[model samples]
Structures are given as structure tokens and as C-alpha cells.
Target: MTQALSQTRTGGPALPQERRLVTDIPGPRSTELLARKKAAVADGVGTTLPVFVEAAGGGVIVDADGNSLIDLGSGIAVVSVGNAAPGVVRAVTEQVAAFTHTCFMVTPYAGYVEVCEALAELTPGDHAKKSALFNSGAEAVENAVKIARVATGRDAVGVFDHAYHGRTNLTMAMTAKNMPYKNGFGPFASEIYRAPMSYPFRDGLSGEEAAARAIDHLDKQVGVANLACIAIEPILGEGGFIEPAPGFLPALAAWAKDNGVLFIADEIQSGFCRTGAWFAVDDEGVIPDLVTTAKGIAGGLPLAGVTGRAEIMDSVHVGGLGGTYGGNPVACAAALGSIAEMKEHRLDARALEIGTLIRGRLEKLAAEHAVIADIRGRGAMQAIELCAPGTKDPDAARAAAVSAYCHKSGVVTLTCGTWGNVFRFLPPLVISDALLEEAFDVVAEAFAATA
Candidate 1:
């Protein structure tokens, strides 16, 4: 919370990949900008850390105050290939120079088609798949529901507890969180039901048992005939990186098949090598009927898509789907560049390496911290749920304190989950071991000081 006069961007230091705090947290320049933002920006739009980012690369962000903070939150799981990645930069610059937009719905271009092709090729399953591009994860999820309803002629959608689909009206109805997401903004869309998730730490039910309970609940409550789709995040993202028990996803996918309901895997937060694989469901060999993707899909550009069985995706009327700026050419090109970076660097394996390293470090932290109730998630997308010592009561305050401590120490961290007690880490895949270890060192210091 310390501050001094704002520093000017005299194009300082070479933007190194290390954590360098040249000023206090939210230094003078950032404070001034924060003042401007408060004056001009809507109160509804809140910032996690108010330090204005001047530049970011690799695993660090350079703030206006010339502070380099180790980025443990990769812009909320985007920029997996790193900020200003060579390929993404090249593609974006080239596309910008060539043309900006023609509206894909009007004079469709190759970039959109190419991105769709990539989705089909990379998404789970060898079955004939087709894709439709969108502007965000919410759009992809919403469109997946539309495709499923049109294909099945059903009105009901089954979502899970601790789910975070999006903030759109229809998605708000589908989402389980209430406070910030749906609190007063309800009278939401109808026929969206919630099923219990297979949370081993909290429920302690076997994967099969939890899946059975969820299936039975949906069957008895919603009736299979009326269910258009069952949407879920394979590795629950905003719900604290909660990875469903091993058999949960497969069982749900199977039930969806038996019930003629489309199984939609919302990979918005866990896809694109974030979970040590192309998709989190891949760990259990669960091939969803429809998979929605965004976040890391287009480097940092806004791009998302729903890739599913050809028939289901094509069942909708040609004109029924699409938006004015759904698949911007610049975004599509960025996706291409991002995909190239992923392939060339084999980031899938890199994610696994990061998972192992982070999981190990977190395990050590948990061993010393009684507040760590659960250590979960996969790959670079990991989290530690905080609770009162020796009890299951979520310690949101402790989580917030630890996060704040990290923030002030020049380490960017994030907290998530329905209870706001899950401290999650999503470092860029390209981060170096030195930086990662140093970030964890800072986290360890935060824990000791907070304790």
C-alpha cells in the first residue's frame, strides 16, 4: 500500500524476466492512473491489482512504476505462449497491415476457416468434427447450448455445481456462483439445472459415486428427454481449479451418450495446454460431444469456438448462428500464430513439467501451512484451497491476505472458487525455473508473514 510520486516511462530497463520492484506497490504513476480510471471507468468494472502494466513478456509484467512482477496469473489463463510471442506478433502485425476486419459473417475470410480447421484437428476425438468461431468463451458456451438444443430439440441444460460458464445472461443462469455473477441480475434464462460436482476434498465420494449421484439427480429432476446438453469444465476453472475425480468426466460423458444429451466440455480456462494436455478431459479419455474453447486459444486476442460432431454443429440453420464481430480476422490470425507456438515448442509437455514443479512446491508449502485445506488442479493451472486450521470452513480472509502480500511483494497472484478461498496459480508456460522458484519463494514468505 506504499506509494510515491509516479514514475514516467522513459523507456527504462530492457524489460528483464526477473521480478524487480523499483517503486512501492501501485507507485505514483499507477496511483495517478488509478485515479483517472476511478473517475472515468464504471464502478462495476473492478481491477485485481491496480498497478498499470506498461509491458509484459515471458513470465513477468513491467508496470508503469518500472516494477517487474512475476506473473503467476497469465492474464487469467490467456497468453500461455507468453505475451507478445513472436508468432502471435508476426501474425497480428501481418493481418493488421493486410486488413483489419470485413466482418466474418459478411465477407468471410480464410483466417476464420483456418482457425476452425485447427480446432477440428486439435480438439478431442477423430470423429468428423466442425467448428463455429466466436468472440469469447461465453459466446462459445452459449452457442454450444444453441447447437445442442437445435440438434436435440430439447430445452433443458444441465450444469454442475461450482461451475463458471460466463457472465452473459444465459450463461449467468448456467453459472452456479451468485454474488458477483448473478446476485441481483437474475430473472435469468430458464431450464438450467445444477448437479453436484465430484469434489474429492469436500465430498469425499468416489468418482463413480459422485457421477452416479449427479446423473441420478439430473435424471430425476430434469428428465433425459428434455435435456439438450450437460455443460461442464473438465478441470473446473473459476470454481478453484477443481479437477473432478478421475472417473467423473468419463462417467458424465457416458451418461450423456446414453441419454442422447450433448456433453459439452467448457475448456475455456483449461484448454490450450493449460492443463498439461490439449484438453483436461483428455486425461480420462472423455471425448465430449461438443467442446467450447477460448482464453488461451488466440494468444491474447479475443477468439473462441465450439467444435463438435459435424451433424450437431451443422444442424442449426446457417443464418441462426454468428455475430457481427464473432471471428475477427486479426483474432483468427493470432490463433494461427499461437497454435504454431504451441506446436513448435511442444507446450503440452511443458505444461506437464510445470504441473510437476508447481505441485511439488505447493505440497511443501501445504506441509508447513495448516490453512491449506486442499492442493488441487493440474499442469500450470494449479490452486490451493484455504480453510480454517483443522476445519473445512473456508478462510477467504487468509487467502485474500496472502494474495495481497504477494501483490505488495511484486508477485502477481490470483484467488478463485465459489468461496473465494482458493489461491490459484497460472504462470505462463514459458516461465523459467529460476523465476518460478523465486515466485514460490515469495509465496512462502507471504505464508510465513501472514501466519
Candidate 2:
């Protein structure tokens, strides 16, 4: 690290933005907590890293043992405004003191309405829009499907290969992976169909060709008349940070409009400035009929929303939507604050800067390491797919080894992909360029050591 890269406090956190290790990762306190967690928590609740966090902000998470680890995962892309962001903190504090919850469905609140208005203004399309808030990405997705089905009077919903919607029964059926997300959980919901995705690295097809193939499959397998909506992540997230080839999304959107099918953009993990745009679909000028958002929307609070054309969103019966905790007052406040922070800071531009730095570093690493089969994604949401040295065979073992190396070295990295051969990077947008370079240096070392 250079003197110019010296640590400086950012994100208004109490701790300085620096990586410090006083003990081994998952050190004494975290290990003890792990033991307690094992005894009290369910075995199914898996963790990427064993270290238990005491506090986190900017780009570092402080563990119980005083180890300050660089945060590259951003709690699975949920804290893009940075953990404990000042705006979120202040809004949440005031809201909590005023009132916790009267239930939005019962009495409603200004925060919830304000958040809906923000979503309407921010999401793609100049047409009149409406929004319904939910508690998670899954809830938003499920609701979007419900709205589409009601509006179109169609039963079938289409998803793409390598897609991951959520853990709910309906979303599980829509998800492509079967291991942990689907496994024994089914019997799942009906009328859920799967289609091919535009994965440029693997398929080697042009965007227009790939979209044609997907449309062909849907038309043959599930007729357009029967399909309610074709939901997709503008940039695939859990399935790997796969950005569909250029022109692919626009083609699909055109097809959906030609037919009566609703084009639902699942922006759960890629929205809120994480992808250098308000939403990934904006890159290709694809205006989706329905857009689902979560993860980074509320700093770290649980809030999700489905925003779309006014008529379609209002198609569903008044009481047909909503849950007990869908738009909790506190979460709504956090969403307001989070959106304020994003607009004030222009984190979208910051994401572009961070992406340029990280992608450039990874490109250099890829040039050196044959194990890096592909490097892809936009803004802070980037990833490298690990493969055998001489072939395109997925090398999940190498990915695992590198992740372990990162964990031991006190960098909180994450891995994802259908085959588990992808090392994804989702650093907080608030992360400084110097810190990002430091994290990439650690990543480079891991690749070299593992190789």
C-alpha cells in the first residue's frame, strides 16, 4: 500500500476506514458466538464467513475481536449506501422515537408513501407509475407476478436459465438452481416456465440471437398468450453477475410488448446505484412493465417494492396484496433516508468509478491467471469465473480455495454461480478507490498463492 493510499475516515463511521487484524479471523469472540449460533440457530441458515460483526461502515466491518475486514460483499448487496449510513441512522432514529408501527395496511404513513413516490420517479419510463412496498425481494417478485397474472389473465410465468428469484415456493419454482434454493422444498407452484438466458461467455451468441432463442423457447414451450410475465434480473445476481449481451434486453422487452406479456425486471440485487445506473435495464433503454427492487433500497433494513405502469399495478384487488410487515414504518423511513443519501452523493457515478478501478485490476489479474475464465458485471457488482487452467471446465475448487484465502486474510469476499465457480465482488459504493485497490491486491495475492 502506498502513503497516498493511507486510511481516512469516511461514511461518518466511528472507526477509521482501515483494515486491522488483532486476532485470527473468526477469532475468540466470534468462535464462541458461532458455537452459540450453532446451538440456537437452525443448521440450514448458512453463512459465507464465520466472523461475527460488531459494527461496520464505509468499506470495513469490525468483528468482535477488533479485526477490521474489508467489506466486498456489502451484506449481499444490501448496504450500498454503506452500513449505518448517517442519513439512514438519523431517519431511523427519529422514526423509532416517534412510532414503531401502526401497520401501513391499517393506517398508512408518509414515509411509505414517500418511498413509493421516489420509486415512481426513479425507475425507468416516463409513463404514470405506481408502487407497492413489500418486505423482501421475494415478496416483491411474488407480488409482481400476482399483478401481472391479474392484469393479463394468464397463468404462466417465465424465468431464465441460471436465475435465482428467492426462497418462497413460487420463486423457488421460478429459480433455475435446485440444490439449496429448491432441493426438497418443492412441490412448487405451477405454470412457472424456464427459458435460456443470454450468457455471452458460455453460449457465444450475439444479443439478438440469444434473445431470439429465448423467445423461441418460450413460444414453443409456453405460448405467449398463456404467459403472464417474463421476469428476469437485468443483470443476473445470485446466478452470477451475468450482464446479458447488448441488445438482448431490448429485444426481449420488444417481444413482451408485442405480445401481452409483462416484462418484469428483477432489480433486486442490481438496483439502487450498485450497477452504475438507477437500474441495469437503463443501460440498454429497456423499459420494463414491472420492476422489483430490494437489497440496497433501505441501507440495511428489510424493504422491497414492485413499481410499474399505473394500470397494471392497480389491477390487483385492494386487499389482494400486502402482508403484516410488508411496509413497516421503520423500514420505510430507512428507505427514504437511503434514497436521499444516494441522490445527494450521486452513488451512481461512484459505482462507475469503483467499477473502472476494480475491473481494470481484475483485467490485469485475468491476464496473469489462466484460472480466471471470465470477468464480468457493471459498477461495484463485478465477478470472476474460475475455471481449469487450460480448459473452460468450471473449477469450483479454485474458487473455494481463493475465498478461503480471502477469509483468512481478513477480507470479506463472496462466491456465487450455478456451478459455484464464481468469485463475486460487491463492495459498498462508499468504498474509496484506495481501499478497493487494497482489496484487489489481496485478491490478486490469493489467486497467485492458490495457483
Candidate 3:
């Protein structure tokens, strides 16, 4: 490695390359563990692959079966600060040594309050805001809806198609994709409705057209007046990294205001500088009444938060929103350190840097491959969609093959999209340029070989 990258502190190509496997992916040891997992783990816990990991550090994940894999997926965008980041490790270690859980709602702790204060200061908007922490992103989303409904005294909550809010009963109802997430899980929460999202790749509709279509639907079908809140992922995550068109999000925000509806931006996957901004909604300079965050918020730790207007947040009665382990000391400590690392390292700029590199490389690949239909995303949260050339139908098989190829080659990637044709890249913002370029090289080779 070059001296510059070798000595660097954060993500770029300065990191080490991952080692490929000489044996089957689930080589001996992993096979043994998989068998044990089958007996001990619940069936509901699903994994994309059978690779069993021993340890993960920096931008690489080492499997128990003796394979070191590049982590382009970053635990599905949860570890943007990197795996085993020094800051996170130090904070978590110190916090765990002192105390693990105190039940913030019961006894409270400095760490929890400190994290909330940090969120109040860090999340988008200059207005006075308050925060309520949760154990997962879905809980934060669910609470945001509840708070909005109670504040507005309206029962109807509007969500967009292709959105993946969470798997909880209410979130399942709010989510747009039905197959895997909502399939066989029914009797979902009520008062939830789906609106058309602005997906430029397959939809072929302009921002104005998409927003107009959705607005017309609301006006004619549901009537926005009955809506309490309109929740959306500023950059749709599982629905594909589909960024709202130029006029789409802004128009929706304006309409929400006009119709007395609260706007909630679910920044679970795209927030905390992953999109080259604190939150994706800030790109449009639109202020959401409520902002839901998780994933990268606490590095790899499980911590979710909902930050919004102080008045609206206070509207909820005491004990109405909170959890026992929502902001555990360990999670809060990790969050504090993660935020500090983000600012000190300028991860926002790093995200833009990574975005440019990946986009350029993927654009070249798209030009050469007929199946590569579109390249879209913002900052480090980028994705490529596959299609049967000349047709809008999804090519999920090709996407899956590409993912498997990447896995075998020692680079870990993920697939998303309602149609399952999009390959998403969620590398940690702290990854080195060298490691990133190397991973991209593997991805390109995978596509070339498959082609």
C-alpha cells in the first residue's frame, strides 16, 4: 500500500485488500457453525449467505472458515463509521465497563441524555428539536407516526410505494413491498395507505409527473386533509436507493404543509453524512416535522431516534415515547464517539469522494453492459439496477448472480429494490480509497465474467 493511504486514519483506498477463498464458501468450520445455527437460531432470522464470520475490523470481515471478505455492504449501511472503529470501540468498552443498561426511562443516565442532546444538535433543521430514542429503526418510525397522529389528531398515515419502513406490525403496514417483508405476516396496522414513489429508472416519469401523479391520487382517493403524516425515506433504502426527483420531495413537503399534514423523513439508511449531508432531506432544504434515524446513528450498535419540532414532540405525554434499552449507555457512548468521528474526519466530504469514484466506475460498466440499465444514488449510498435490455422488467437473476460472484471473489455486496434488480453499495464512509477501488475492481470483474 502507498505510504499516504497506509497512514491515513479514515476510509479510502488506504485500507488492506481482502483475501479470497480457496475452498467452498461454507468450508468445514462454517458448515459446522451453520448446522449449530440451524438448531439454535430462529427461522425468522434470515441471512443473505451462509458465510460464518469470526471477526470483522476496518473494512474487512474475516469468516470463521478462513476467508477475509471486503465489506462493501457495511452491515446493510449500519456501520458507516467502519467495523470496530477505534472511537466506537473505545467508547463502547468504557461504557460497558461502567454499566450496560439502566433503563433510560426508569433511572436515566448521562449517556442517553448526552446522545439525545447530540441528536438535537446534529440532525437537520435549525428549529428547536427534541429526541426520543428506540431500540430499532422500525420502532423510531412507528413512534414518529404515532406522535404525528396524536399531534395532528388525524388517523390517516401516508407512505410511498417501494418504501421499506420496518417489519413491525405498524411498519409492515407502512412498508410498500409485500412479498418477503409482509408476506404471510398479516393483520397489519390500519390507517396506512401507499402513494406512488418517484422512481426515475424504471418508471420513466419526471419528478413533476411523479409528484403530480401521487398528488392527484391523494387528492382524489384519500384526500390529504385526513392524513396525519406523510413518511418517506429521503433516499429510499430497500425500495432501492431511489432518490426523489428534483421537484418531487419539495413538492410533497409543500403539499403536506398545505393540507395540514406532517412530513416525516425516515433517514434510517441515508442519514448521518452517508448521503454527503446530515440527512438526505436537507438536500432540498426542506424541513421535516419528524426525522427518523437508526443504522449508522450509533455506528454498529442498535440505537434509533426520532428528532422533530420541539412543540410536536412535547405534545406527546410523558411516558408516551421511550424504551428500556432504547438508548443504552453502550449505544449512547458509541453514538457520541461516532458523531465525533464523523465531524473530525469530515465523513461528509468522504462520502462525496466515494460517490464520485463509484459513479464513474459504474457508469463505465453500464456503458459496456446491456443488462446494466441505470446507475442512481447519492453520496456513498449508491446502486445499479439490472434489466432485460430494451425492457423495463427486472433482471433479479442477473443481480443475484452478480452478488454471488462478488461474494466468491471476496467482496460483499447487497441487493435491494421492490423488484429485486438493484445492487446497492453501502461501504463505510471510513473505507480507504485503495480498498474501495479494489472492491470496485472485483465488482467490475464480476460483471464482466457474468457478461
Write candidate 3's Cα lDDT for 1-451 as tens digits: 2324322433344334455675677678888998999999998888887888877756677788778787889898888887767678789999889989879888888988898899889887788999998989999999999999889999998899899999999999999888889999999998898889998875778878898999898777787778999999999999988987788998988888888899999999999999898888878898899999999988889999999999999999988988778888898999998998889878888889989989999998998898988889999999998999887779999999989998878888999998999999998887767778889898999998887
RMSD of each: 4.4, 1.9, 2.2
Whole-model lDDT per candidate: 0.90, 0.91, 0.86
Q: Give candidate 1 regions above 4 Å deviation.
A: 1-13
Best by TM-score: 2
Point out the higher-scoring one by lDDT: 1 or 3. Answer: 1
Clash count for each candidate, listed in order shown:
2, 0, 10
Query: How well does candidate 3 score on lDDT at residue 83?
Result: 71
In model 2, the runs with Cα more than 4 Å from the true position are 1-13
Better of 1 and 2 by TM-score: 2
* Order of models, best TM-score first: 2, 1, 3
Model 3 steric clash pairs? 11-430, 11-431, 11-432, 12-431, 12-432, 12-433, 13-432, 13-433, 13-434, 13-435
lDDT accuracy of residue 64 in candidate 3: 83
lDDT of 2 by residue, 317-420 (tens): 87999998988999999999999989988889989988999999999999999999999999889999998987879999999999999999989999999999
Which residue pairs collide, candidate 1? 6-28, 6-29
